[model samples]
Target: MTQHILGGCLCGAVRYRLTERPYNSGLCHCETCRRTGSAPALPWAGIACAAFAITQGAPVAYRSSARVVRSFCGTCGSPLTYFHADKPDKIDVMTCSLDDAEAFPPTEHVWVSEKLAWDVLGDGLPAYATGERET
Candidate 1:
């Protein structure tokens, strides 16, 4: 049996469902993620593009970088998903947006080179200084 995961934006303006389980669950401390989320790090799960679908309202997209696009709810400014043009097969969803976020714990830390000194999450998971571990 397939377990579907559901998530949405803060104001419920945008909703989504993952038809399959996510992988590469991790915390990203990259500068882009930090600035975009206004936080020290962002927790994300990788879902195949084909398995992800918008179930409700449309999300506004921002071209955060040449290779990446971030989507959010325009009304509530709640971050939703992250996509890389180079990797169209997968999309990263904010773990916090999930209906059962506690079920998806991060297994590693990525972009540790940009990690803030004060923001320490003592999970002792494998840390990647720059890029993520190849899945």
Candidate 2:
């Protein structure tokens, strides 16, 4: 049996499916992520661009920076995916957008140093000050 990652926008205007499990998924609390997501950290799900596809309404784009961009629903305004223009073959999805978000839990926390004043990240996942783990 194959487990497909399925989900859509809040207003049901958009939907998508992925046949493969995320190669890597985690929570990111970097300043960029915090501001773009408007949350302490955005939970991400990664699937090969080839394995990811949207079968419904189109998602909007926000050029977060020169290196990164975000996609979301124009109707519901739900943050959806992140990707680097230079790295076009893959995307970091917002796990919350998945119909069954419980299928994926964060494996790690990125950018703990800039988390937030009142954000309590207590899931026991090893916290990283940046992308790499501290020695």
Alpha carbon deviation, residue 109, candidate 2 (Å)? 0.2
Candidate 2 lDDT over 1-135, as tens digits, reads 287778887888888888788888899998988887788788998888988889998999889888888988898788888998777898888999999888889999988888897989778988898866788
Off by over 4 Å in 1: none
Q: TM-scores of the models, in the given order? A: 0.94, 0.89
Predicted candidate 1 versus true structure: per-residue lDDT over 9-79, tens digit per residue: 88998999999888679989999999878899998999899999999999999999889999999999988
Which candidate ranks first by TM-score, i.e. highest?
1
For model 2 the TM-score comes to: 0.89
Give per-candidate clash totals: 0, 0
| Model 2 clashing residue pairs (backbone) | none
Candidate 1 at 7: error in angstroms? 0.3
